[model samples]
Target: MGMITWNCTEVEEFILLGLTRRPGMQIVLFVIFLISYVISLKGNVLIIFISRISPRLHTPMYFFLSNLSFLDIWYTSSIVPKMLINLLSFKKSISFHGCFTQLFIHLCLGGSECYLLLAMAYDRYVAICSPLHYTTIMHSSLCIKMASGCWIGGLINSLIHTLFALRLSFCGPNVINHFFCEVPSVLELSCTDASLNKTIIFFCAMLVVMGPFFLIIITYGYIINSILKINTSVGRKKAFSTCASHITVVTLFYGTIIFMYMRPGDIHVANQDKMATLFYSVVTPMLNPLIYTLRNKEVKGVLLEITRKRHVP
Candidate 1:
C-alpha cells in the first residue's frame, strides 16, 4: 500500500484554464458574466423577499418558489465568483481543497434543486387535482418536511460523490480544462483507474437527475388529466397557467443536464460540455426568478403594490 501510494506525487493545487485565454475575450466574458451574476443575485433575493412579505404569496407554491430562489442564490454564488476572479487574473488557479469544496457545494445545491422542483410539481398536482384537500394535504408542516428532505437528500448525494473523489490520486498535469471543478473534469486528471468514479457518477445521475425528472413527468400527467376534466375552458386555462413557469424551468434545466451527463461517451466534446455547463449552472439560475415572476400574476401584483407603497412614502 505504501509503495503504491509513493508512485504518485499528489498535487496541492490545480491550474484552471477557465473559459478563455485571449485577453480581449477575457474582458468581454468578464463583463458579461459579472452582469449576469449581479442580476441573478438581485432577482433571487427579490423573490425571497416578496414571498415572505406578501400574505397572498404564502401558499405552498410560493413557499417552494422562495426556497428555489434561495437555492439559486447560493448555487450561482458557489462557482460564479471564483470564475469571475479567474477570468481577469493571469495565473488562474485553485487550491486542491478549494476545488473540492466548490464541487461538493455545487453538487449539493444542484441535487437539492432537483427534489425541490419535484416538490413544487407535487404541490401543483395537489392544488389542481385534489383542490378541496389541497390545503390539508400540503400543510405548512408537510411543506417544511418536504423542503428539509430535499436538502438532506442533496447533502447525502454530494457527500457520496465527494468521498469517492477523495479516494482518487492525482499525479501530475493538474490543468483543468473547465472554469470550475466539476466531477467529470476532475476525474480526468486522476492518475489512478477512475472507472469506479465514472460508474458511480452514472449511477447517481440516474438517481438524482433522471429519477426526479420521470416523477415530475408522471405528476404532471395527473395534473393535466385533472385540468382537462374541468368543464370550463377558462378554468382549464387558469390551471395550465400556474404550471407554465415550472414546466419551462424544468425543460431548460433538465435538457442541459441530460445533454451534459446522460449521453454516450463517444460523443463527448470539451467545448460543447463547457457551454452546456454554463447554461445550466450560470444562465439557468439567472433566468429562474424572471421565469417565475413574469409567468406569475400574483407575484407581479405584489411587486407592483410594494413599488407603489415605497413611492408614496
Candidate 2:
C-alpha cells in the first residue's frame, strides 16, 4: 500500500517541546492560545455563514472568500486545540499516527489556502482589468473548477511531502522543538540521512510557496496599473479599496510562510519558527474575518442588515 519501510525501529510517539519551557509561562500561554483558538473558530465560522446568507455577497469574490474562511477553520483547528491542551497538561506527547495526521491536514489546508489566494488574485485582476468580461470569464462553473483545483493541488502536495517524510525513520531523541508536528521539526529527529527530504522540501517550498506568491505579485501589478489609468481620484480610491484587504492578507500570510520554510534545514531557529507558526496558524485566521468585515464596506453593510433583520422580528 506504500513505498515506505514500516519495520524501521518503531517510534511510538513524539514529545512536543511547546513554545515556551518556563514553568510559569505555561499557564499564561495556555490562556492566550485558548482565547486565540476560540476567536479563530468564531470569526472564520461567522465569515462563512455571512458570506453564504448575504445575497449581496453572492459573487465570485465572496465565493472565493467563503472557501478561504472554510480553509482557515480547518487550518487552525488542525493544531490549536491540541496545542492548547498540551500547554495545560504535563503530557506533551502525541501518537506517531496523530502527528502525521496533523502534518497532512495542516499542509493540505495551508497549500489549499495558497492556491485559493492565487485564485482570488486572478479574480481581482479580471474584475478590475477586464470588467466587461468579468462575469463571462469567472462564471459559476469556472469558479467551482478553480476552487476545486486549489484543494486538489494542496492534497497532492501534502500527500507527496507526507510520503516523503514517512520514508525516513525517526528514532530516539524523539522530541520536536515546536508546539506542533511540523515537517521540518519532525525531520530534524530522523536517524537516517534526510538530504533527499530536505531537497524536496526546498523545491516544494519554492514551487508551492514562492510560485503562488510571485503570481499574486504579478497580478496585483496589473491591477495597480489598471487602477492608475482611471481619470478620477474617486475611481482610483474605489479600485484600490477593492483589492487592499486582499493585499494585506497576502502580506500577512506569505510573510510568515516564506520566512519559515525558505531556509536551509540546519539553519532553522526553533523559537523564531514557533512564533512565525503562531502568527500564521492562529493570528492570521482570526484577522482574516476582521480584515474583510471591517475594511470592506459591502460586508459591513450586509452584516448590519443581518443584525437588523434579526432584531426587527
For candidate 1, which ten residues in a row score worst on lDDT? Answer: 1-10
Which residue pairs in candidate 1 collide? none
Best by lDDT, which number? 1
lDDT of 2 at 180: 96
Query: In model 2, where do residues sit more than 4 Å from their true spots?
Result: 1-7
Please provide, for model 1 over 144-250, each residue's C-alpha lDDT reduced to its tens digit, 9 standing for 90 to 100: 99999999989999998898888888887899999999889998999888777788888888999999999999999999999989999999999999999999999
How many Å off is the CA of 247 in candidate 2?
A: 0.2
Q: What lDDT does the true structure give each of the candidates?
A: 0.92, 0.91
